[model samples]
Target: MGRTKRKRLKKYEQNSINLCYEEHLVSLQKWMSNKGWKNHKKLSLKLFPETGRGISSKITVGANEVLLSIPMNIMITYTTVKLDIPVKNIFTIHESLALFLIKEKEKGINSYWRDYINSLPEKLPPLTWLANEEEIESFPSDIKLNVEYTTTNFKNFLNKIRDFIPNNSTLADSLLKWAYVMVNTRAVYVDPHIICEESSLNLLKDEPSMALCPFLDMFNHNYLSNTEVSIINEGRCLFYELRTLSSCKKYEQIFISYGNHDNVKLLTEYGFFLPDNCYDNIKFTLDEVLKILKFNLDNNKYKFIKEHDLHNNLYIGYDGVSYNLKAVLFIGWCGVINRLDSIIFSSNYPSLFLEKKLPDLIKGLLVIKKNEFTNDLRQIMSGRIVTESAQMVLEFVKFRIDFISEVILEYR
Candidate 1:
């Protein structure tokens, strides 16, 4: 798969997509400027039709140039927040930050990160964790199971920190949910030692090193975007420097990649998925493969697969079937393996008789996967699960079926 070709947005859609946050941006710029933050002369905040709100390079930005150099002081992390003894001992980085964000949001203008906080949306796109019964029902079994698991864990965590939340506030849980999403979706990686105090770092239950960078979070993710971020430490000052690995022309949206993630992961985490994501893999569990095969494997072959951990990476993507998948199926087809190592790892194995039967073996799985997508899409399209983020999920499902069909055709 390649990058999806986007159609130009109509006038109204363009207006809607570009959220009106000019005043927030202005205030943030002023506040940031005072804190030793000097934005690149050529860069400005923009609402791109394709990627929503992001930074645009007004002039051509050359490779290796600094796009953004945000100060560490301006970032909200463990270092910035005054963590209480209880929170500092029990909570992870994300949990502590979520609690802090909620408290800060209560401070309308008093908060130091007020402008940056104001710039963020009250709620992000509809996430799987927030999906109600009706909305979750439309999701595929795999996605449904994950959503259920995530929702349970989220509620359990909230229960633990309910004491910090005000009893009178009606929007407490939802506010906490928003804060959780805010931290997970927007927080960038930093070394734990860089932010966490040595005294409390070890006491924290989990290791989570992340910082909420103000303007830097505005740069939306693109898997193909080549950018590198590091801390620039001088004797008296420290700056979070983001360098461009590639050039950007005038008025182009400059992207920084979070990481190489597939549509499924992106959908679950961020409530959005990139179309034609090259990193996508149609993964199947051990039971799923067993169900698809619907044949009892001999003890010897089963043990061999289990021993080698060949059952773990059963997947197919744009490239082709995974080596593990091929090896697993090959074991089923062959009567005797003279050399176990050679049969599984040999380069010449693909040219063997197993190659003749591989396509047939995979076609069944593809058909099943395609059917799942079609069924999920049909349910989502019924208008029951109404949400903008559900629409993104629907779009991804539609894309997946078409993508699988193409792969099936190629395999033929």
Candidate 2:
């Protein structure tokens, strides 16, 4: 099965979308200027039909053109927080930053970041937003686990900072969560080596490794993007195109690679998934696969797996079954291979254990998972009032299933 593609926005649709964010861009441009940052002027914020908001070219950009440069003071970093408050902090980087955003939120129109914050999404639709138990239950195991993990972190953070805020109870949990999501989705990794020598080194030492870039955050991700972001020039970070975007017409969307992240990483961290993502794959925990195989894990083979820490590194890719899966299967079905030999063979030559029927077995398993994804899609589609965000979750799951099915066909 071929993957579903994202539809291109018509010219009228683009114009309408551009009008929606024009006020936002105007306000944000002033903030950039106030902070001494330089805008390339060749780029503009445009709405992509496929990826919502993205940066687009206003003119023909050449190879190695520096698109934008954000000053260090403009970034929301651990240093930024420290400069605001001289008192030593007990909170971790993320907690402190979340608190910083909450403070800014409390300031309303008085806040220096009012323009940027106002432009932020009023509602972040991560699993955190799913209030009903039924809605939560409908998600797949992997997505459910991600939600649980992030929720736990959020709760822990709330506990630590609850006493710090005056009238803390007045602060809505949803606002803090939205701030947290915003930081997670937008922050860029700033390396220590790139820090300019003239800047105050005190904050740099205590600063978190990540910092949020204002206008730069608007660049949507593409796995095949030729643009690269670097912080080496002076104290500022710049985004530049590596290849000449000759193929891209005027106003065409240009993207930055957020590292070759898979669909799961993108969805969990950024609240969106790429349609027909090339990096898409089905992940299976060892215990889940063991349950599927119905293998009693108390044997010496299982002990060997635990001793070497091989049990955790297992999954299925779009290409075929993972090597770890083959090893465990060989140990379970054909015990002639000892633990070490099986491990070595699995690492070196997994194809040796590929059975004629293994693909069919996997196909059957994938079908079961695919049905689960499709059933959720059907439930959402048939609803009286379903959110577009909820519908996106279904689309992501359907893409995963379709990708798995494509792999299954290749094996057959």
- For 1-412, candidate 2 gives per-residue lDDT tens digits of 3333433432233541563347777888888778676655466777677667877766767666666767776777755675554234445556666777878988999998888776676767453234344555566667778778877887877876575555778778778777777777777777643433335444432546677777777877777676666654453443322333323445777777788778878876676777656666676667766667666655677877677666865666655666666566556554445446745553653554555546655665566666666776676455542555455567777777676666666656
| Among all candidates shown, the one with the greatest TM-score | 1
The list of candidate 1 runs beyond 4 A from truth reads: 1-21, 163-171
Q: Output the TM-score of candidate 2.
A: 0.80
Task: Judge candidate 1 at residue 157 and give its lDDT.
Answer: 63
Off by over 4 Å in 2: 1-21, 83-89, 125-131, 192-207, 233-249, 294-298, 338-352, 355-361, 371-389
Which is the leading candidate under lDDT? 1
lDDT of each: 0.76, 0.64
Q: What digit string (tens of lDDT, one per residue) describes model 1 on residues 324-360?
A: 9888878777787667778677745756555678888
* Candidate 2: residue 410 lDDT (0-100): 62
Show pairs that collide, candidate 2: none
